[model samples]
Target: MVISNKALRFIIATFVICLPFISMANPEKDTTIVQTVVAHEGAEASHEAHAEPTDVKSKVKAFIKHHVLDSHEFSFFQDDETGVHYGFSLPIIIYDNGFQIFSSSKFEHGEAVAESNGNFYKINHHDGKIYKTDAAGTITEDEKSGHPTNVRPLDLSITKSVLSILIAAVLMFFIFTGLAKSYAKNNGIASGAGRIFEPVVLFIRDEIAIPNIGEKHYKKYMSYLLTIFFFILFLNIFGLMPFGINVTGNLTITFSLAILTFLITNLTANKNYWGHIFWMPGVPKPMRIVLAPIELLGVVIKPFSLMIRLYANIFAGHIVLMSIIGLMFIFKSWIGSSLSFGLSFALSILEILVAFLQAYIFTLLSALYFGMAVEEHHHEEAHH
Candidate 1:
């Protein structure tokens, strides 16, 4: 028997999303192998708190400096003996006025500084220690740490989430264009690849679009339903990739989608939907007034729920995966690595499922909105 294109596409989409996380399952080994080796050797060589060896190992020193230093100009590195982790070379401070420095190296060990004022300052640090050097070549003392820049976006900047959005867009274009061609060649007859996608498209058409918008009006809304369904599906799949950046992980994207739904729903809402929301014909005058504000709030809250649901689910998944991978470095043992591999594998599988589920939910909810907007109560009661 021939496998359905829908099933094949679903499987391929799942793989695309899960591949990145599966590949990232063993990040601990790549990140901390040197730290583990040094720890083992140090245990044999010295017993004192700070007596490991002052030939001055880079990793130990950099790690220490990062935790202990407190100035804005100075920083420390992790100091991998294998040189696998690159050291910092960029100036600690970048300014177009006289100079600028943006280091692209993976900084695990070393020290650097930028001097400004009488006191030495630390750059790139955790706790109180310095992590890298500044332009002036000075290290910071405790009680002198400068606040570092938090790279995470606070207000939906493009720099923060553009790549994720772009990835989603590109993936959507490829899949949908292929789908469109498949659809046309098959002459809407569901041949070849169209067979795979037809059911899903049909599902949206029959269950979502027709029921919600009513068959008479559903045709007008088909393009919007198709766009929302595929856009969400593409983003959901992209979120699952190992190297994946979560587009839906950001509230901004979700909020934007919600706003679009809100606009379309309200713009297209028939007389009955609004009447039911603001005034009930059977209800007492006093009761209608009391319910009006609550009903109005629901309109806003409905889209708000849409935004939060998608953002929270996607964000939580990414954070959980990152944290689990981070644990591998913290464990410092074979058991940790082994357990991480298994857990990561399982989670990757689950993420695949979540990708499809989220897409379905978004599409389903959107359809429901469209249905509410276009529903006609008088027409429904005519038979009765």
Candidate 2:
């Protein structure tokens, strides 16, 4: 049983050499370490996936589109941590079999279904339209059009645009009413806020209404001209505010304004105006018939142009301005971000001027149309 020192030393060396391999071969410990590493990496990836947008361009485009589109709620901003939106909800009024009225918050930012009078409704995120859906909030889409097949109720909701319009209207009423009272109080001299706005009012009456609509007839249309000018100006200014209200940029709103102009022009047209359009006094009999339809077509084209011009200009301005602002976040560098911020600020200032310019142009064109409709033609005097 006497062991040699050489054999004992050999055994010790062999054990020392194999210790690392034995540890490496242990499956349970290695598996636990591997699982821990994998779980850490997976969690980091998931956090990143949720925290940041994968495609910056797509995010920017979506933000711009959302800026220009009307929504049921006035969302100021969203919290990054909680993912909760900060804004008040407007009322949603829909007429199906009967009126179904509810607060827009019931939709939970288009993530939930709203029930009323035994009917269920859901908001289509794609178009922001409310559609009748089942309790599960299932939406059936048409295969060809890709639009929802669910029946849409008659929407009479006071959307963001509608709310902005109402605000502008109330603001305009108070402003002008105060101005009128000031004029009456101060012996026809406007005081206070009236003093500030009087010059603009006189400019509209003198430069726009009288020149285009004639001094004799301008008085009757001055009230409407002033109302529209300030109404549009206020809405455009509102759009540029941080509140994200794009009332004037809405097509339907512009269309409504154009319709008002159309009605006023044609309804107040003189007999001479209709005569010039249907049967030109100066043209040959055969040629007059040819020109008549074309002239009548011009009537419809005029208002259509007004609607398109206002809508396109305001809508495009908002998109461009917002896109520039979005570039600041994408750049992620001091110099590039500063440049983007500078450009955004300059564009915002220019947008303020555009807001006024658009209002002026709309008012000017509307007055010009009135001038054409009420213009007197002295054919007898011209013949003499």
Instruction: Please tell me which predicted candidate would have the highest TM-score against the true structure.
Output: 2
Estimate, for each residue in 257-350, the C-alpha lDDT of model 2 and write its tens digit.
Answer: 9999999999999999999899888777899989999999999999999999999999999988999899776654555566678889999999
Model 1 scores worst on lDDT over the 10 consecutive residues at 151-160
lDDT of 2 at 178: 92
Instruction: Name the TM-score of candidate 2.
Output: 0.85
Model 2 CA lDDT for position 239:
96
TM-score for each model: 0.60, 0.85
Relative to the true structure, candidate 2 has a C-alpha RMSD (angstroms) of 17.5
lDDT score, candidate 2, position 90: 98
State the C-alpha lDDT per candidate: 0.62, 0.87
Scored by lDDT, model 1 comes in at 0.62
Question: lDDT of candidate 2?
Answer: 0.87
